[model samples]
Target: MPIAEVFLGAFLQVLFDRLASHELLKLAQHKGIDALLKNWEKKLTSIDQVLIDAEDRQLTGDRGVKLWLEDLRNLVYDMEDLLDELVTESAKNKSEAEPSKVPFLLPSCCFNLSSRAFMFDRKMRSKMEEMDNRLKDIITRKDIMRLTEYNGQRSAYRPQNLPFPTTHLTEELFIGRENKKMEILELLTGEEDDGTYMDIKKIPIVGMPGLGKTALAQQVFNDDRVANYFDVKAWACVSDDFDVFSITRSILETTNPQLARECKTLNSLQDELTKNLSGKKFLVVLDDLWDKNYENWIFLLKPFRSGVKGSKIIVTTRDREVASMVDAQLITLEVLTLDYCMELFAFHALGVRNFNHHPNLEVLGRKIVEKCKGLPLAVKALAGLLRTTNNPREWEDILNSKIWDIPEDRINVLPALKLSYLHLPSHLKRCFAYCAIFPKDYEIQRDELICWWIAEGLVEAKEAKNQWNAGLNYFNDLVQLILTWGSLRVITVIYL
Candidate 1:
């Protein structure tokens, strides 16, 4: 399943609670819509388990099952929009109503508002009836559709017993990143022009989550030339939270553990950092940064300013906006070519860099490699999956499996991708999850995506002057996070 369904049940439950709340229930009763809402609540609750079952089966990547699940997901979105409409209308009517006064001596203005509310209520009741009928029709298809219930335990794509190094970077196992490593090294060691005022320069290594931004940064950070060039070196994995004090404390710890243990306040930490870095060139690697606040970034860089010229900070992140905020030179990593991907896959799958010994597996192996889409992490993961299974039939089975069908827990790539998704804000998560509704490689128009986001109520209208601008901002944030392509008119949801 696309994992969006994992959240669908909870979202529906929230809506149910909102509908059943005292204020809304009283309003519904007054408008003669309570009975309809009661019916919806009952039907929705009954089918909640069905949605969960469907979600599990969808993970198997069966086309028919996926279609059915998409239908259910669309209905959920529609129901949510309808609920929002009802809440908005109710609030508007309450605001327009006259204050409680002599009931018998109500003014004509009050009568007009009452008539409008009644008409709106009737319209809403009709809409609810239509939705109820649609839900009934969808439920009746369950038996005919033969939706399979998931019974097997959740399995990830990668094997648990495999000796493949998924987390740790071994220089020998690392392939296809030599050129990128050299480029980053050159940036770190290369001198800046005298015209540039900043003493410490920053270079951001940005790419999609599984594109190996961290690994590449690790390679560069560990390079002998880099180690020899700088007087001091420190590393921090600043994932998500970019607390100024915590980061300063980490830098202090990396440079001098004793000073870090002794310093309790931010001022003391900064003083320690300054004392350690003053007049000495240093290299700092802030890996996996997600913060985009420009002020916060500048505040973090204050102590680094005391370091000597040629001091460098290499920030590895999935967001280009973070790179821009730090005024860093950007080195965006691209997906590997087929040649390098094949080489990496062979090394993991067959314990060699080439498939000469198993010529029979080459053709099938290349087909499997194509499914990886030149992502190094995915290539390594699939290779790890095939390491023990040398049979041609087993290779073919892997080649045929959909990426979504692969269990994320066992698969290094899927889990890495899931982490990126999990870190997204709730609104962005909804918007991005909805993209799963499109077919893989489907070229999405920017405007159409924004419109869908607005319709789904994923983007807050009050946050911007109009829904269009708000949607644009949401889209840009997703782009910055490397979740989607970076183009206005064209974008594609990368197959996870």
Candidate 2:
């Protein structure tokens, strides 16, 4: 029970899982309180505006914020129970009116509310009014608590679609990963279908968060020479949530965007994918995968089987269990060596490989890198913030940051991450901040995150771009802010 954020999972389930259901909507309709439900929906949306900020405030041992969060938690749970009751009651009503219509798991005899409709309505309406007042009271305390609503700048984020990854254009950007990238390239191009790849020749680049697994995968993916060996190529960002239909669609979108748009079903998408990949030496990059279900894995590969024997699928994941799912000849990535980490910091900060000239900043920079504990993302984020300045005091200040004082085990996010987060435009900040609620090393699918932002109203929709596209731009901005294969100068992993 993380009083600040863990309850968000339960809150989201109530908001999304139950509230979005047709059964609840039908119940609201029958009670003629659909308008009231919609108003509550708006209230919950308003509550979301302050939650991440409240979570941040709660970390300070702000007793007031903590109390507010506790109150909010109770309210969310009560609302969830109420919604569940409504749906259950609605289902029971349906089962009673048409006895054969009972839902599979729910027994008609299990009814909590009476078959008498007025009794149910009388009890529910009073509860709904109290919840309504509860939500409003929470909303009023929000301003007193100094919760800033994030209505982001729509104009600041204008990035278009995801940048196409290119290895040749970005190969020189890597630091110590050249060897690993070369080794993987050797496997991908070579017929090393040894025990490592098992039967499918899938290479799993397994590592903990921020080790540059995705960056390494990108290097291998964008390698100029890789294009020559594979006849068909596709890259899919398969984060923790495994939706085979979406993944199949993502692969198709890479191979044939027009055809992908035409596809509506898994069967159709896979058929198109199989036809396009048949007899080809394909290279499929499934980046950041977390799912370990064997049946889903097999089902996902139904189209890939059409590709030739030399076909390759590069899977990057944090879970070794995921590697086991693929019977991976695992290429587990470790943190960069301290020297490499320092060099990475220097390269990003001073635009030099080492602190040969600026000896004044070298000591502080090394100390800062040491604090980062060889996490490339941490080092790069800190270094990138200092890219334009060679000031020693600034370096010292960064080295002495309280973020570094947050013991490594206790802090889920890197201190440098907070520094980097501070530099982000307001628009990207809200979306990126929401990500903090996820546990460390949580694998987030790109679109899934974008959709969450849209659903949560974190994305500001303008007439020019709908919420989804606005979210995409927010996502892209945050992606580039952290790591982009094409542009990030220091070292190349965003979510590392």
Candidate 3:
């Protein structure tokens, strides 16, 4: 859809809200809709005449303003009975939620004034902004823009980006758990009907940190049924700060890269998104959520009310409380089973099936995998290291090491992975450590982080083809070493 379509959609919504508030039932019986329609027609005709004159003189100075007026007029004319029905339903719910006073209606006079001001070509952007401000003021007076209360209890964003499906036992690594995955899918995507609001399914996948929540989510995302079921699919990585703009951009980029490019702010991005998702069956996956506060989630999800029935919002989080707050049908993920664990282990270790050839290596490999204790990160990291070396001595040495013999905490691959970290240039080391400040799964901005690294004397500006190129290469090298992760653990510059 075009930008003109969005503006029109918003206008129709405003009109519908106004109509519903005016008590259409009473209007049809008393004032009569024919009279009301006539009134609207007369006002609209006058507005259209003014817009037509503005278009003729657009070459003088009003090109942008005239274009905006035309778009707004087109939007009003685009309103249909379908939109009126939705607004009526929403108004009924609103009235039930708060019944103490007479409902306030949207003012078309305000809209028309705004549209006319937008037609003034003398100060294009300023005039348009002024019109928007006026419109917001009217909406606020009507109590539609009231700020709701929110809680701020979480101290930090504990992001969990699991590298595997599960880690209960060896079987978990080898045999894929399609059945369990589906059970989780059913729980997360079940439909529920309540009389007041139209029924919609809400599924949430929750689990402990590093317990394969994200991996399981990936499986659901790629499932054939899910792909065909949802009309609109979007993925938002809600790491740490929960920057609305970045998440919205990620959603748009999932299916509409062009729209993502056109968005620069959260409001604009959301406006574009709401229009794209309206009346469509949408499946939105919000991954790595740490903010458990209900109010935050509600505000973010408000626009989703426009989505079609059966649309589901899948949230992957470590906090059960977050799942509850979002009113989601919960799928609590647990550790992988023994067999499944082994399968995942084998995937990382041999990189292929039929790994029974080397008797000695197979025995040692099983022992090594058992030591990993179903943690996919440990298995994958070890497998990646082992794949490069052909020496049996190296494998045996790894099996016999104190690092491998220590408790799980001491056996953390961070220390072994530190070998890769240690090899980095001094400047790159500082750059890598800078990543610690970010929450897990936080997408780091390329230019900004690089600039900080340069400012901190971590990267010499004179070392490369150009400062920008040097910064990019240094960032890329660190990413390749797994010192950071994103988009399948390959570093892509992200802002937020």
Q: Pick the candidate with the highest lDDT.
A: 2
Error of 2 at 144 (Å): 19
Q: What is the lDDT of residue 365 in candidate 1?
A: 89
lDDT to native, each model: 0.67, 0.70, 0.52
For residues 1-496, what per-residue lDDT tens digits would candidate 2 score against the true structure? Answer: 2223423522443354466667677666655577777888787777776665565565445678878888888888798788878777777667554333222223336334355854665677678879989989988888788886645321122333546544323423478788888889988888732222224588999988778887798788878788988777888877777889988998998789999999999899999998988767789989888898999999999888877777899999989999988986899898899999988888878889989999998889888998887778777777777776777766765675444554566655556765465444445655665676565446579888887877665566634358777777676666665453222221111223
Q: In angstroms, how far off is 266's CA in candidate 1?
A: 2.7
Candidate 2: how many backbone clashes? Answer: 3
Q: List candidate 1 stretches off by more than 4 Å.
A: 1-56, 60-171, 192-198, 403-496
lDDT string for model 1 (212-320, tens) is 7877876787778988898888887676667788779888987899999999999999999988887778899887788988888888888998777788898988888
Candidate 3 lDDT tens digits, 317-372: 87888788778568876666555555555565566543565555776677766765
Between prediction 1 and prediction 2, which has the larger TM-score?
2
What is the lDDT, from 0 to 100, of the residue 484 in candidate 1?
22
TM per prediction: 0.53, 0.58, 0.52
Least accurate 10 contiguous residues by lDDT in model 2: 485-494
Question: Please, what's the RMSD in Å of model 3?
Answer: 28.7
Best by TM-score: 2
